[model samples]
Target: MRQLKIAVVMLLIGGLLTTAAFFLAFYTAEVQRFGTVTLSEEIDSAYPLVGVSNEGLQYERPWFSQKIFYFHVPVAEASFLVLILSAFFGVRFLTTRRKEYDTKSRIAMETALTFVALTMITGVLWTKASWGVWWDWEPRLTTYFIMMLLMVAYFVLRNSIEDEERRAVYAAAFAVIAAIDAPISFFITRLIPSQHPVVFKSGFATSNLLPFILAQVGMLMIGYAIYVMRMSEERMRERLEVAKEALED
Candidate 1:
């Protein structure tokens, strides 16, 4: 009951912060020119030329498509963070063989799945806006796709097992292994050539950074609220099951 109240409070606060961030990103934040193009070939006469460089190259200011970053980045980061949390609980479950830890791990995985799905939705839109494509098999995208598959597989593995303890063990082990891909996906752009922008490497202007931070913090709070609410529901269901079994006996 207390947890439910706290979850409601967090949901309200998180919703307000996320809404404020969205408005600020669209209005108050300065539109950033993410990439500048230097024309090597014969430049089109209709191109919006910013200026000419010292080497006599035409510099064209590209269209602003970075607005999606405010949402996309925070969701992506939250997904990985939740995945790690799931894995942490998974590890604890393995060491202690406790049902509560397994429950927490499962709930965290569910939250991660939610964040991952949102990341994919926003990522697809960002990809279309930036790369002019709906999908691409780049390193980051491919690895994240695989992570989502692994998350799905975790639940499948859980449901397939009839023994509760065995099911928990297998799911916990799988989650730990799946978490190994998170860092790989995160650093893929730095390790190899990729079209994805490295937001942290270049840094951000004050106007851009504010909304980004708000979105990130708000998203995490919402994610936690979701986890808490789900856990509460699960506990109620467990109690009902116990009562039903007692009455039947």
Candidate 2:
């Protein structure tokens, strides 16, 4: 009960902080600009031509879609973290053949799927808003889209198996594979040419950092809350299962 209470409190805090981050991004953080807009008239000209500027209607680009970064990047990071966690617990379950570890692994995967779905949704919005298109088969986007399908396949594979132990083993193996695939997706996108922005290396303004950090922390808190809340529900379900077996005996 106390643990659940703590989870609720953290969930509330996460919600409030995430809300604060939204307002701060809107009012305090500097408005972010999209990709560099090349000027038609000033290819060999001054430094002023690089930005999304309005040089009397000839070179004006709208600075939009930057607002999505605060929420999107954090959730994306959180999703990756959860994927690692799910894979870690999966490895542990395989090592020990323990039901508890399997439970944790499954729950973590559930949380990761939820986060990844949000990442994809936000990413689509960013793509549409910035590139004026709903979708593209860019490297990073393609890798993540594949990753989401594999994640979904993990559950599908589990449901198809009748034996509990076999299901757990297969799922654990796939979770590990998915975990390996995620970093490959991220770095492979970097190694190859892609339209994706490498935000860490290119950097954000100092003023933008605060809200981004706030959103990241708040999103992780919400993630932890999700894990804990799901664990509690799973434990209750297990207890019900045990009660049914006792009645049958």
Candidate 3:
């Protein structure tokens, strides 16, 4: 009962924060000028690099799209954090053979999958608007793509196994490897050069900071709420199973 009450309070807080973040992002944050390009009929003329031109060829992004960054970055960060949690619980389950750890791992992974999907969708849109491409093999993007694939593989492995214990063991092993692989992918992606221009440099303006921070805190709270709710459901199911087993005996 206490846990349930705590979960309910968290859900309410998370909902409020999320709503506040949404309004902040939409209403605040300075409009960022991405870059400039010439629209002249000189088809082969070299264009001046961004931030170097004195001409008025540059244009600022739509306020709505710029605001998307606040939400997108937070969700992306939360997804990675949740993936790490999934791997941690996976390791715990393998070492202790505890059903509770498995339950936690599974729920964390599910939450991660949900966030990852959102990250991918928002990332693609950001890419399109910023890079003029629907997709690019950029470092951050590529690492996330691989992360998403590893998540799918984790579920595939779980579905293939028949025995509960064996499934838990196999999934745990894969989770560890996947967790390790995610950082490696990130490193390799950053190491490689790409045409995509990096935005959101260090030392963001005060206008941008508020929305970004609010979005991040809100997303994290929501992620925690989702995890707790799922965990409660799993616990209830486990309790029901125990009750059924005792009755059968």
Candidate 4:
């Protein structure tokens, strides 16, 4: 019950922070501008070009798409964080041989999977909008793809093993390795850059930062809430198993 209350409180905080972040992103952040435009010749005067020099047209994000950056970045970060948690729990399970550890690891992995999916989706969208491509073999994209595969493999390996104890051990080993590999993949991807720039230097404006931070805090809270809820459920299930064993005796 105490754990449940803690989970609920964290969840509430996460929700409020997320809400605040949303408002900050939309209302407070300065609208990102590409560049200024001048009164041009015969072409469409309303739209501003990247290098074209124009003195008249106002420069602004052709769409509100830039706003997505705040949410996207935070979510991506959260995904990696959750993935790390999964790996940590995996290690704990392997060392302790505790069912609770396995349960926690699985729950964390599930949350990580969801966040990673979100990151991929948002990343694709951002690429299309900002880079003019639906997909590219950029370092970040490639690394994230591999991370996704590793996550999938983790589950597959778990499913194939019939014995619960063996399954947990195998999953723990895989999770640890996968977790180690994810950052390596990310780092290596950056080292061998393609057309994509190695670093994006566009610093967020104050307004944007507020919402971005809020979203991050909120997302993290939600992630914790999910883990706690899943932990509680697993605990209950364990209790039932114990009860069944008693009945048989």
Candidate 5:
């Protein structure tokens, strides 16, 4: 119960920080120009472009589309972190053959799935804004999609089997296998040519950096809070099941 209260407090703090980051991203962060569009003659445009001089007109891009970055990157990073956590517990379960480890692995995978879905949704929005496409078969995008499917398959694999111990072993093995793709998905952008921006290679300006860092930290806190809360709920459910069985006996 004390842990649950701490989780709630963390969740509230995370929500506040994430909200602050969102506002800072839109209001405080400097607007970045996408690229300079040079034109020989002046033309009517809807976009907020600067430099209307007759000598080679240059247009400045708006910050409308790029605002998604603040939310998208953090969610994507959180997803990968949770996926690795699930894999870690899965390995532990395999080594010890413990029910608690299996429960932890399953819950972590569930949280990973939620974040993965958010990442994909935001990725699609970012792609459409930047590339004018809702979906693309780009290396990073494709690899992440495959990872999501593998996560979905993990639950399916668990539910299909009748034997409890066998299901845990098989699911644990599958989770470890699924986790192999997470690193591939993350590093694929660095390893190959992709439309996605590499944050590590390309540094962020101070204005953007603060909000990004805040969002990242807040998101991780929220993820941990969620994991803790879910684990508590699972334990409570297990206890109820045990009490019911005892009453029946």
Candidate 6:
């Protein structure tokens, strides 16, 4: 109970911090200009929104997609981090063959998937706002989309198997493989020419870092809160199952 109280507190704190970050992004953070066309590009080129001007200043970049950074980035990072957590638990379950660890792994994966879904939704919004399109078959986006499918497949595979031990083992094995996509999703652009902006290639503006950090920490806290809550719920369900079995006996 005390732990659950702590989880609740954590959730509230996370929500507050994320909200604060969202507001700060618009008010205090330095607005960033994303692109300036190279000298090779004609000064009188058709793409006027990007390129250096005669006055020697970068063209005004849009901030509409930038606002999504606070929300989308945090959630996306949280998803990847939680996906690692789930994979770690999956490893633990395989070594231990313990139901408790399996339950933890399953719950963690579910939480990861929830965050991934949020990431995808926010990503699409960023896509529309920034790229002016609904969807694209780009490498980075495709990588995550495949990652989500693999996660869903892991559960479906678990459901198909009848034996408890076998199900846990198979799910654990699949989860580790699924996590490969997590890193792939992150670094996909580095390996190839891609449209996704590489934020770290140059670095973030000093003013942008604070809210970004705040949002990241908040998202991590929220992810933990969710994992803890799900573990509690799974425990309760286990207890109910035991009671049912006892009644039948």
lDDT measured at residue 236 in model 1 versus the true structure, 0 to 100: 98
Superposed model 2: Cα runs more than 4 Å off = 35-56, 59-62
10 residues in a row with least lDDT, candidate 4: 52-61
Instruction: Report the alpha-carbon TM-score of model 6 versus the true structure.
Output: 0.88
Leading candidate by TM-score: 5
Q: What is the lDDT of residue 192 in candidate 1?
A: 98
Instruction: Please give the lDDT score at residue 139 for candidate 2.
Output: 91
Question: How much is 57 displaced in model 2, in angstroms?
Answer: 3.5
Q: What are the Cα lDDT values of the candidates? A: 0.90, 0.87, 0.78, 0.78, 0.91, 0.85
Candidate 1, residues 1-249: lDDT per residue as tens digits? Answer: 899999989988888888989999988887766455776555765546666676555655545678888989999999999999999999999999999999999999999999999999999998998888999999999999999999999999999999999999999999998888899999999999988889889887898899999998999889999999999999999999999999999
RMSD of each: 3.9, 3.9, 4.7, 3.7, 3.1, 4.7
**How do all models score by TM-score?**
0.89, 0.89, 0.84, 0.83, 0.91, 0.88
* Model 2 per-residue lDDT tens digits across residues 21-57: 9998888988665445655455443323445445421
In terms of lDDT, the best-performing candidate is: 5
For all candidates, what are the clash counts?
0, 0, 0, 8, 0, 0
The sequence of per-residue lDDT tens digits that candidate 3 reaches over residues 20-101 is: 8788766677766555554423243334333323444433233345666888878977888888899999999988999889
lDDT of 5 at 161: 100
Ten-residue region with minimum lDDT total, candidate 2: 52-61
C-alpha root-mean-square deviation, candidate 3:
4.7
Candidate 6 per-residue lDDT over residues 1-249, each given as its tens digit: 677888899999999999888888988888765555345334543335453566563544545577887888889889898888888989999888888888888899999999999999999998887888989999989998999999999889989999999999999888899998999999998889889877679688777888888899999999999999988888888899999999999
lDDT of 6 at 225: 96
Candidate 6 Cα errors over 4 Å, as ranges: 34-59, 247-249
Flag regions of model 5 displaced more than 4 Å: 36-58
Decoy 3 TM-score against native: 0.84
Candidate 2 vs 4: which has more lDDT:
2
